[model samples]
Target: MDRLAGTSGFGGVYGAGIARPQRGSSIVIGYESALAFWRRSRVEDPALTRELLAQLYPDDMLATLDAEALAADTSLRPLELPNSPFERIHHAALALGLREPVDIVVGKDAARRRSPSARCHVWSGPVSDGLLVGVEPGVYICSPELIVAQLASELGLYKTISLAMELCGSYSLLVNGACEYGVPSSTSHSRISSVLRLSDSFRGIDVAKQAALYSIDGSASPRETVLAVMLSLPRRLGGWGCGKPLLNAEIMLSAAAARECSRSSLRADLLFDEADLDVEYQGREWHTKPEDRTSDEARQNALMMMGKSCLFISREQISDEARMDGIALLIRSRLGLRPYRRPLSTGMSLRRHQMMLDFGLA
Candidate 1:
């Protein structure tokens, strides 16, 4: 392939009356060079190569080359070929050693191309260099900011921000083994802002901006982030519109109080200080353990005794619309907000409806 750039083009090499090899004979002399060239280039497919060869060469000309011998050539090693950007991103993430699973662009055609063992959830949007980080050669993955923006596009303003908070922590699912991805906690906010700036003209940029406005830097888990967003998002966006709350806010305890509680301090997942509200999200994975359940119950009781009203949002409740609506109403009532009145006709745009559904607003 490289030699094609020289004065002796493919035509020049063959037009010089070069002798043809036997039909079933191996052409091993330049096999390594050809294999190296193919590996360094794009993906390889024997069928596609044959089709192209048939187009470029006469049938008799192609018949002289041994297809079986070419295919069985040990000089050509197998190379990994990713079928889509998602696969490329997965490989790149592994190469870069990212701590959390980053979101990838999955356009309208994704359903047709989806595989059973896909690693990342797809986002429907335009993907460009602005959204990807190239790690190893030919491996491109979404950058942290791009990941946040993509999440915003799919998950809406509130949830995306909350996700950013969770991703900002040291521990993320993307990292390998016991070690966590060592991302700086403070970088989450700034990176989101930077991404917003770069993606000013991008589709769904408005939603990304809105999510960034509510994103805080400290969320221990995805459930916690969702709970915070649900509590703080405005009613117009299909949320209760409660005031923004501190996330993972610590409650100091006296030595005697600590002894009684068997801990020196407690951190509320979401805390509305003025309203004296403490919200905790108990995902089935963590809260199912007996020890965790017991500790959580004790913590709730302690918080209640301290004049703080506690709301425990379960994983099931989060998934159920009726329960979520009830929770929303309860939060509004506690925050002294008026009862939510659904519009007679929402007149909602298709984009808005999609965004609402993506953010769990619906």
Candidate 2:
């Protein structure tokens, strides 16, 4: 429910509910044009970089970018493109030991499965990190960590869309289910597939003028309702989610909703103890317990360090140490900085891991 815009923590519920501004309207997030201006500046002035960060990140995130630290590290230069602002931040973070460098490939199926999934073939390498800088209106330095986080945050937004769609679709389906013989019949379930297909087809057509008529039809059958729900998704998500498959969006939405749903269900003794969620980076695994000193000030500090604007706390208030660990864990997880290990039970040693594995083990 908390919509923290520009903050590194939470991207908020459903991406500010803002329409994906038209293609040429302002500037798209992942397009090449977004960082085109960076090619012009040889030194890439610090002030210019700071301004770009201001435009791309929330004001609360400025300190974490470590403008001063970046300026001091003269070896760093503007990252090459064909990437995104989020990617650039990720590289910088890796270099700064803020996160692990991960190899992100966009393929038909990232996991090599039949389904269309954004495959994340994480390679272990030195943690890399970078700052977000705006080169021009359409261009900005790519922060890989931020981009991953942004994508992760989308899971929540997509959930809202799906649930809303499901509720509406289910309501109409219930009616259609009962339309048979004046009583609900199991045969109505078969209509779901037909409706899904119809919805997919409808996406290609314009139904602006037929809204009312379609609404009436949709109420007649669960299939029509399901189709209506699918058809309505593009409007909320802003044009079919790029190259990603429909199922990927479904999964992302489900994950986000699941996390939010579990927030209040966490046990009092359970702090930041998730193994996958609480990770190790740069040879150190951040502590899993919440900081002992709990207070609003500690929570704010943790949020600041973690670059997150949202918090899902347990019965005991979060402390500074807990916040710090949370931030480190988040950075590591987002950047893929943690040790790349096969499941411990699998019995694979680090030496057997790929070369890239050792490179990222630190």
Candidate 3:
């Protein structure tokens, strides 16, 4: 996406813009520093990183990053940043309140000693391509997609899938692997690296591809992410293997239902459109409120009027493996799919159990 040249963002940071910087300068926030940034900032879905930085940092802190990183040219060229990956990561660490030794990505050619600086960890790799997302005129962070690909190298497939789900969904994942349902996803579909967009050029692309296979967008809460993964992922991987549902899908109500519900349309948490069903996730935190419960009932009635039966999945129900499996069976039956022949053995238990563990459900 082309960034607006002069628009201002939260805390006086231009939400999208790049200042000209000298070529061959390479200061980019990455790895552990990137993790810290992603965790601390709960940016709105359609947002830029500078908004977060601007709130936490002074304007001048980004001024150096904005300088000498580009050349004056009417035309653009292959992107490169200034050559100080360490300085970049250090600043990002400070900005994100990271206390651990900074992790910086250096070119493969950069020298490494048997023992390098104790204060920072060095990763040998070049920061090139479109992997680096510009946060401001000069500052950059690993793009959300790049971060996923980088992390996939070290994480298991379940964890990788969990991370991909959060990224694809409309919510953010916390450092502790908890979903911050209140925090909207920072990366938009156009900006996030998606399953279909996984490229061979990236490291761990194969793993990322696998992880993103069943991930769908528009999940507004953590439970929805888990629910979708549980239902949609292949049975071989311990998912119920029901058809993946469209998450947070907006459905316009018929004239009668709309007037009855007092709304033109409603978004279902997990929409089984083909089955004419709406699976709603009721979070313990808010849905218990009397007013919210009343509203949910009304929404369900309105949906039913359109021939879509509504199935409610409570936060409590999601926590129980037996209950969730039962729910999945019910959904598959409603969708007219054959029963999933669940296997009992062959090492499926741990892998199946790990999905819950990774998602903090277990």
Winner by lDDT? 3
lDDT of each: 0.49, 0.25, 0.60
lDDT of 2 by residue, 72-152 (tens): 321222222232334443443343222222223221232221212111322111111222333334333333222222222
lDDT of 3 at 163: 68
Query: What is the alpha-carbon lDDT for the whole of candidate 1?
Result: 0.49
Model 2 is weakest, by summed lDDT over 10 consecutive residues, at 240-249
Task: Mark the regions of model 2 whose C-alpha exceeds 4 Å error after superposition.
Answer: 1-23, 27-43, 59-134, 137-144, 148-352, 355-362
Candidate 3 least-lDDT 10 residues: 67-76
Backbone clashes under 3 angstroms, per model: 3, 42, 14
Worst 10 residues of 1 by lDDT: 26-35
Model 1: runs farther than 4 Å from truth?
1-143, 150-159, 170-186, 194-199, 285-288, 341-362
Best by TM-score: 3
* TM-score of each model, in listed order: 0.53, 0.20, 0.73
Give lDDT tens digits, candidate 1, residues 108-190: 34332343323233343323222232234544334445556654655656556655675554334321122223323323554
Task: Report the error of model 1 at residue 110, Å.
Answer: 26
